[model samples]
Target: MNSTGRRARILVTVIAGVLLAALATATVLIARRNADPAPGGGADPVAAASPGAGRPGGPGLRVLSNGLLSTVSLADPAGPRTVTEQHCDRAYTAGGTTACLTPAGALSAPRLLVLDEGLRVKRSVSLAGLPNRTRVSPDGRMAGWTLFVGGDSYAGGGFSTRTGILDTRTGEVIGSLEEFAVFRDGKRYRAADINVWGVTFAADSNRFYATVSSGGVRSLAEGDVAARTLRTLADNVECPSLSPDGTRIAFKQAVGADPGKGWRLTVYDLATGRRTESAETRSVDDQAAWLDDRTLAYGLQRGDGTNDVWTVPADGGGEPRVLVQGANSPAVLPAAR
Candidate 1:
């Protein structure tokens, strides 16, 4: 064929191939967007309900799991609506919203996933370092999490833990507590002193607390939420739970020298600074929740990984009653609207 005719034919072939490829890509994207189930069928109704299914004032527990954050109504605990699904290790809720911490991956650095009440990913904040044990402030204005820097030898994983507070609105690092000393009643406590975990904030967001164990001695720290200042309340403790009134704290304690043998649930009066053990069963790794100023809720694990939820009186009386199964991290709603 003539040179000009051959060149024209070659150009036409290339253009047709490009158009075909573009059409195929578009088709795949359209299919993926519509693949999400609609209402009805075996799909979860709560999740199928628009992106804004659960609003700010709704009755549900927002939980983070395997990088996906979802909400389950307290009334219907099993009905969960996945709001955000990313590769995250943990999730927490504050101020009627949810936040997730992404795990380190090949292509992406660790980040914070913030979601609205409707289970929609609203924003993503890149974190400078790896984060662990994340908690949100009660006011929803601030978020705090522990960051693990260089490696150290701790039983769980690392020795050095740095706590950072971030401004949720601006995504700024507002405060951090890196000092390795434990201060109690205006005195510097030693670092080799306590094993801390389960860090959380009070209702007012003014104070933060954690479960600390030292040389068989266990206690709770009532620290300045903003300044990171700390003061010890009591010792010989396990998982600690704060009451809604902020006037009391509940925890589990080892009844004998060998805590691994088992533990007993206890309550502490913040005002009087007294620790009282309950008549509850002896269990390890138990967590307690305050249903109210007088009522407490907790979970007990059986020989199997399955667990039973129970409730007792904060005043150290009454028999332990069952609440639910496979339930953990119970935060009672405000009497249900």
Candidate 2:
């Protein structure tokens, strides 16, 4: 062949290589998108309710009843056996250990009580000067809550709110947050009362996040546990629960004119800061706790105060499946010892 013929062949080869590279890229992209978990995969079933249905369970599963926060051993398929009775808004158990809320009406304060497998209170910590929201860390080593202090009744109704952390081991106050601003009506308003609730901590316990509700406005706040500085993470969010991996937070979003109406469950990606609502959830009242990195458990109430426990996927696809009926303040045991 002549020189020109040789050059033409080379060019043809280069073009073929580029085409193959493009095809390979496209194939990889398709694979990633396919592997992506369905948007709210396990979550969808929980939202769709059917008659005579109950929540799915796994080995060693246990439920802490809401009204009394009673401990029931689910391992016995016959029925849930009561291990203890302690009226708590929330309960968490890990490695045969449990922690719950004991109304500290005695001190005119609420206390978080940690218990062992034998149903004995190991420790009781006072929350007298804190805000209404409280939660214990995943490891059950630390407790976090919100506090409102030093505000006139006019600054967003003159209530002062702050976030606080307590050292469960020593019963010491580790950190507190008081700096926060409330946004409303296209204007930002400053307030002494931050009113943070729905407290959850990252797996590493390095960062903490909570919902700040004030003057009919709700926003998520994140705090650096070491530095003790609080900043708003997202606005118009409530009932925030951190993923087990600490990469995302599951929460409920309000819809329609009334805040209570059109409430939906949504998960916010912490790394990307993108939010997605469950297609299955029509209306949810409050609370979404992570069953795992991929699954979320929460409570939903109909018109009446009666509620049910349900679980959904974080990526969003499957309908919600009821875990239990007439149960509120649902808490999951930490993934195995």
lDDT per residue (tens digit) for residues 175-288 in model 2: 445543344444565764456666787756657787776556778777666665556767778768787787888887767424536667899988888988875456765567
Clashes of each: 4, 37
- Cα error, residue 125 of model 1, in Å, equals 6.1
Write the residue-wise lDDT of candidate 1 on 1-337 in tens digits: 9999999999999999999999998888677544432211233313443333333355555443333444455555555443443335555666655556666644345666565544455556666456655666666666666545545322333344545566657656643453434676678777653555556678776677776555556667766755656677777654566776777778767667356466778887778988877767666354565656898766665677555556788887888876655544344433223
Misplaced by over 4 Å in model 1 are 1-58, 62-91, 101-112, 122-134, 146-164, 174-181, 190-195, 212-216, 284-287, 307-310, 333-337
> What TM-score, over all chains together, does every model reach?
0.63, 0.65
lDDT of each: 0.59, 0.59
Model 2, runs deviating above 4 Å: 1-62, 71-79, 94-97, 104-109, 128-133, 146-163, 174-176, 179-190, 213-217, 256-262, 302-304, 334-337
Give the winner by TM-score.
Answer: 2
